[model samples]
Target: MRLGIIGVGHLASALVKGVLRTGFLTAENIVLAPRGHSAQLRAQFGCTIAEDNAGLVNACDTVLLAVRPQDAVAAVSGLPWRSDQIVLSACAGVSIADLAPYVQAAQVVRIMPTIAAQFGESATLVYPALPQLAPLLAALGKSYELKSEDHFEVGSVSAAIFGWAQALIGASSDWSSDKGMDRAQARALIAQTFISAGTMVAKTDEPVSQLLDSLATPGGITEAGLKHLENTAAIEAWNGAADAALGKLEKRR
Candidate 1:
């Protein structure tokens, strides 16, 4: 499919790399809006660079909107949207309803994909799943479709969680290094540990709590750490952070 990208920022750039790497779309088939990293991408990938947003919209049947949350509406407004066009928006906290009036005759779908898309590992989130976009989404990584906009908003919090996970990994790696582990080894070990943990939960049918219970056996190292985290209310704090993110998203609507 011919895809147009309105906001060619970091995340959008990663997605461009992802789709191209997977051969989901060719550089010639992609159209990029003129701002942000568009020029760099065009030079590097031989992708088409549109004269303007209008030109980009006119050239492609499916458009990926990746502008800032506040700039999303303005960027899409007055575009030459067609009845068969699909607009996949990655702007956090912006709802399809908010773009409906501006993107006339076009289908606006909300999507949240992380920078991991660059490695074809993004756990992309989609609302009101469109069958036509499945292959594109799958090329980046696993895609989860939320049942409704409300659930999509809740799922959007995973975007922030992704960064938090990275931060935790970094901190853990540093701690390991401080304790005399090789820096590179520590980083790799910590990162892979996280991947393994996530893979276990994702690939198994057993409840998460049960899996954790098995790992955190009585009097074990895992149990000791779990006790400490619980005593320090780490889980509660994590929930509070997620709640705060959800609150901000709700306010954006």
Candidate 2:
């Protein structure tokens, strides 16, 4: 399917790269509306650059609205959208009701994807769970069709954890390097650890507490770290970060 992307920011750029990498869409079939880092994207992906939003929408059947939440209304309102186009929005916290008046499309889907999308590993969340968009979303990563806008908002908050996860890995790597480990090796090892953890969590149906119990044997090193982490309030701090992110998303329409 021909794709048109408005707002060529980092996340949208990752989606474009992932789709192309997976051969879901060819460069010739995609057009990007110029915005932040658009020139670099056009050069890197060999995709067409539309002079304006209307131009972009006019050139494709599917349009991805990737503008920031605050800019979504204005950006889409100014565009001349076709009634047949499937408008999939990646703007955080912006619901279908907030976007419908501006887009005026027959189909609108809200989506949330992480930076992992660049490698086709993102957990993409779609609202209203339209079957038509499933294949395309799945091409980018794991596709979840949420039943309601409320569910999509919750998914967005969850997706924000990817950023925090990267930070945690970086912090771990820094600690390792400070103890005389090679910085590059430390980063690679920490990345592998995260990858392995994710794989285990995804593959196992066991409760996390049960999994932790398996690792945190009495007087073991895992138990020691768990105690230290609990004493340091690490888990509570992460929960607080999630709450803060949800608070911002909840404030949006």
Candidate 3:
């Protein structure tokens, strides 16, 4: 497939690296619009750089729209979109309805992928799952297909949670370092701990509560920490943060 990327920002760059690393698409088959990190990507990966958005649209069978939500419509407006082409948008809070007028006959699909795409570890979210996108999504990382646009919007909040997870990892790492642990070792350990925890949940058939209960034995360190977190209402605070993020996304719509 001839893949084109209109926005070459951080997430877009990560995706390009991921798709290439996975051998899902070669550099020769990828085309980048002439803006943002397009030149850098072309220099690094030998991908073609289009002279303009129209040229990029004309050249590729699929275009990834990664521009900011506010710029999405403007960026795609008047473009030479084809009925057979697909426009996969990663612009958060921009609905498919908002893009329909500009894209004309091209099919628009909304997507949310974290920066972890660079390492093929993104928990990408897709709305109205398209069978043709399965391989591409698999190349990026594990994908969660939403049943509807509303569910997709709710799932998109996880993109913010991804950043929050990084922040939590950093804070835990710093705490370890402050207590005299080697910074690099502490960071690696804490990050891997999170990965192990997530992997267990993903692979295990047991309910999440049961899994947690197994670890948090009475009077154990895990139980002590869980008690402290409960006393501090940490879980509630985390939920509040998610609610706020969802609110912001809804507000943008």
Best by lDDT: 1
Model 3 residue 210 distance off true place after TM-score fit, in angstroms: 1.0
Candidates arranged by lDDT, highest first: 1, 3, 2
Worst 10 residues of 3 by lDDT: 244-253
Per-candidate Cα RMSD to the true structure, in Å, reads: 0.8, 1.3, 0.8
For model 3 the local lDDT of residue 52 reads 92
Local accuracy of candidate 3 as per-residue lDDT tens digits, 99-192: 9989999999999999888789999999868899999998899999999888888999999999999999999999999999999999999999
Write the residue-wise lDDT of candidate 1 on 77-116 in tens digits.
Answer: 9988999999999999999999999999999999999999
Each candidate's number of clashing pairs is: 0, 0, 0
On the 0 to 100 scale, the lDDT of residue 90 in model 1 is: 97
How far residue 249's Cα lies from its native spot in candidate 2, in Å, is 0.2
Model 2 per-residue lDDT tens digits across residues 1-253: 8899888898888998889888988989889887787788778878899988888888898898888889888888867788888888999988898888877764788889887888989998888777777778877999887777887787788788988888999999999999999999999999999999888888999998998899899999999999999999999998998889988998997
Q: Show model 3 residue runs off by greater than 4 Å.
A: none
Q: Return the lDDT, model 3, position 190.
A: 100
